[model samples]
Target: MPYKARVYVTLRASVLDPAGTAVQKAIQEQMNVEIQSVRIGKFIEIFLDSPDQTKAHQTIQQICEQFLANPVIEDFCFELDEIPRVSNLASQG
Candidate 1:
């Protein structure tokens, strides 16, 4: 089975986001509404083939913890879903 993973990485709440603040100010200037705060984050996608979902889960956890997200100042979360294999490649096209 093929799995698609969606990862979301964001900075911790205690950390200051200068880029998000700048974006908020920009939005406030263009619009006539009061904006309190804005925070920027990252969205990543990973697709892989695996027979064991548990192993895939552990692999994804390791990937996120070791390579993707920073454990100190950033937090991350992900969702994994199985994608059906396409058997007919030239069915319509």
Candidate 2:
């Protein structure tokens, strides 16, 4: 079975996000809505073919730590779901 993963990468709380701050400032000035805080992050989607759930999770974790997100300043998490394989006959009307 194949699994789909959604990964989110965000700056750690200890790190400062200048882009988020700028967006917040702009919103306050233009819309008159004061936001205490804002944070920007990245979303990534990946599909993998693996029958074992544990192996899939471990692989994704390694990928996140090694390539997807920086471990030092960024924090990452992911959610996985099994995609049901549909046959061509099912799509034919």
Candidate 3:
């Protein structure tokens, strides 16, 4: 079976995001609104085939830990969706 996975990577709360802070500063300067803070992140989605949900999840987590997300200054979350089987007969009929 195939599964769809979504990974969300974001800067840790304690980390300083220079880009986000600059954007917020620009907005505050132009709009004259007091902005507390701003943060930026990345989102990634992938599809994979696996026989078991547990294995799929583990694989996705490994991907995140190894390449998708930076563990030192960032945090991540993931969601998995099971792919529904498609039937050729249903399409033909």
The lDDT of each candidate is 0.92, 0.94, 0.95
Model 2 gets an lDDT of: 0.94
Q: Could you estimate the TM-score for every candidate?
A: 0.90, 0.92, 0.86
Model 3: per-residue lDDT, tens digit, 1-93?
A: 999999999999999899999999999999999999889899999999999899999999999999988899999999999999999999999
Error of 1 at 17 (Å): 0.5
Least accurate 10 contiguous residues by lDDT in model 1: 84-93
Summarize candidate 1's per-residue lDDT along 22-93 as a digit string, tens digits: 999999999967999999989999998888788889889999999989989899999998887777866866
Winner on TM-score between 1 and 3 is: 1
Clashes in each model (backbone N, CA, C under 3 Å)?
0, 0, 0
Ranking of models by TM-score? 2, 1, 3
- Which regions of candidate 1 fall more than 4 Å away from where they truly are? 89-93
**Candidate 3 backbone collisions, by pair:** none
lDDT of 2 by residue, 1-93 (tens): 899999999999999999999999999999998699999999999999987888999999999999989989999999988888898998895
| lDDT rank order | 3, 2, 1
In model 2, which runs have C-alpha deviations exceeding 4 angstroms? none
Q: Which residue pairs in candidate 2 collide? A: none
